[model samples]
Target: MALVASLCNRVIVMYAGRIVEQGPTRAIFKNPQHPYTWSLLRSMPRMDEVGKERLVSIRGVPPDLGKLPTGCKFHPRCRFKVDRCLTEEPPLGEVDPEQLARCWVLMKNVSNPEMQS
Candidate 1:
């Protein structure tokens, strides 16, 4: 991510052979709307934290590629899992001119306060 942030103009986030989000690097880093993006950022070591601090990590195991789950592949590990997430695969929808995201809840309301929703 640090490398991508420094060198790439755009970013594409993929999970389970599917694209979760794509946008200008600054836009995606500054305002990540998807649950996967939120979790990923949270799992990184904070620059503001003092030395010897613990780094956060994403929970749950990565899904098997060959035998993937139905619907939204990320649903099983996502804290924001909803009923729709289990059965309905969300399409990549434009969040802005350059940003796109794939998540039923985020598609409904990217501005949702609780990222865990």
Candidate 2:
């Protein structure tokens, strides 16, 4: 991920063989729109931390690709999942001028306490 952050100009986050989020590397890292992307960023170790901070782990295991979930493949494990997410797969929509995400609950609409720092 450090290598990706340093060497890539763009990033495309995928889940269940589908693109969940895509954008400029900095934009995606600084402000992820999809819940999966947010969870992934949270799980990474930060170099600037002062103490031995435990990384956050995304709960639940990945769904079987052969027998994928009904709606969003990530809904079963997503903390920010809504009723719509369970029944309807969100399209890859524009999050900003340079970002696109596939999620019913965009991170911008939610108050993520972790991102406060």
Once fitted onto the true fold, the runs of candidate 2 whose alpha carbons sit more than 4 angstroms away are: 50-52, 113-117
Predicted candidate 1, C-alpha RMSD:
2.9
For every candidate in turn, the CA RMSD to the true structure comes to: 2.9, 2.5
Worst 10 residues of 1 by lDDT: 107-116
lDDT of 1 at 45: 77
Query: Model 1, 1-117: lDDT tens per residue?
Result: 788899999999998889999999998888887778867876777667857665556678999999899889999888777898998899998888999999887734644444443
Where model 1 places Cα greater than 4 Å from the true spot, the runs are 51-55, 107-117
Q: Candidate 2 at residue 84, lDDT? A: 91
Give the alpha-carbon lDDT of every model.
Answer: 0.82, 0.91
Reference-based TM-score of each model: 0.85, 0.92
Alpha carbon lDDT at 111, candidate 1: 47
lDDT string for model 2 (17-94, tens) is 999999999999999999899989989989898467878788899999999988899999998888999889999999
